[model samples]
Target: MGLKWTDSLEIALDLIEEHPDVDPKQLHFPQLMQWVIALERFDDDPKHCGERILEAIQLCWMDEAD
Candidate 1:
């Protein structure tokens, strides 16, 4: 099965690998959502996403970036 919204670290790792040049701090929420949905391993419903989940993903991404 594909990754879910709860798979924050996995998603973050994928995002880091896919967007190595992107600054997580500068990523807009809408763009972040788009990127997340675009991930090949991501399969959760878009409607299931929310600010909190986005924030968690963003934070995880930032952590991975460092």
Candidate 2:
């Protein structure tokens, strides 16, 4: 199975690898969603993403960044 909307940690890890220089703390949901959708392993419906899911992804990314 590929990455889904619920795969916050996995997505975050991919984001860290894909955008090592990006500051997750400064990203907006739209941009975050866009990047997630563009990830190589991402395989979810963009329409399924919501504010809470995006927040979770961002938080995971920030946590891993530290």
Candidate 3:
């Protein structure tokens, strides 16, 4: 019911596909992980429909070389 690492990757891939302007090189992994954690937390909160977490969430794009 929440976003795991795999889920986050899927979301990230979709976002990268949608936004041509997005640069994967500029992403920071630490910040991205924190956001993912927050997203999962929001999903578990019954009172919150996870709207706040959904607002402007960014996922990092990982290259195969890395």
Candidate 4:
């Protein structure tokens, strides 16, 4: 299952708060950048941050359905 939207948003914000140097907008273009984005996007929504990152990574995967 996909992560809750609030969870995603929280992670994104945490990356922003902790690093304070990484740019969030650049994340959509690169794999590493995307990881950073995911971290920032789900850093404060409960305690499933790790799960949120995994879900985000899977979202980029190309499946047989596609």
Question: Number of the top candidate by lDDT?
Answer: 2
lDDT of each: 0.95, 0.98, 0.44, 0.42
What are the C-alpha RMSDs, in order, of all predicted structures?
A: 0.5, 0.5, 8.6, 9.8
Q: Each prediction's TM-score against the native? A: 0.97, 0.98, 0.36, 0.32
Off by over 4 Å in 2: none
Residue pairs with colliding backbones in model 3 are none
lDDT assessment of candidate 3:
0.44
Per-residue error at 35 for model 1, in Å?
0.3
Compose the digit string of candidate 2's lDDT tens values, residues 1-66. Answer: 899999999999999999999999999999999999999999999999999999999999999999
Per-residue accuracy of model 1 over 1-66 as CA lDDT, tens digit each:
999999999999999999999999999999999999999999999999999999999999998788
Q: Estimate, for each residue in 1-66, the C-alpha lDDT of model 3 and write its tens digit.
A: 554443445556555555546565564545544444454232333333243333334423444113
Candidate 3 or 1, higher lDDT: 1
Q: After superposition, how far is residue 58 of candidate 4 from its true place, in Å?
A: 15
- TM-score between model 1 and native: 0.97
- Rank by TM-score, highest first: 2, 1, 3, 4
Residue-level lDDT for 34 in candidate 1: 98
The alpha-carbon deviation from the true structure for residue 37 of candidate 4, after best TM-score superposition, in angstroms, is: 11
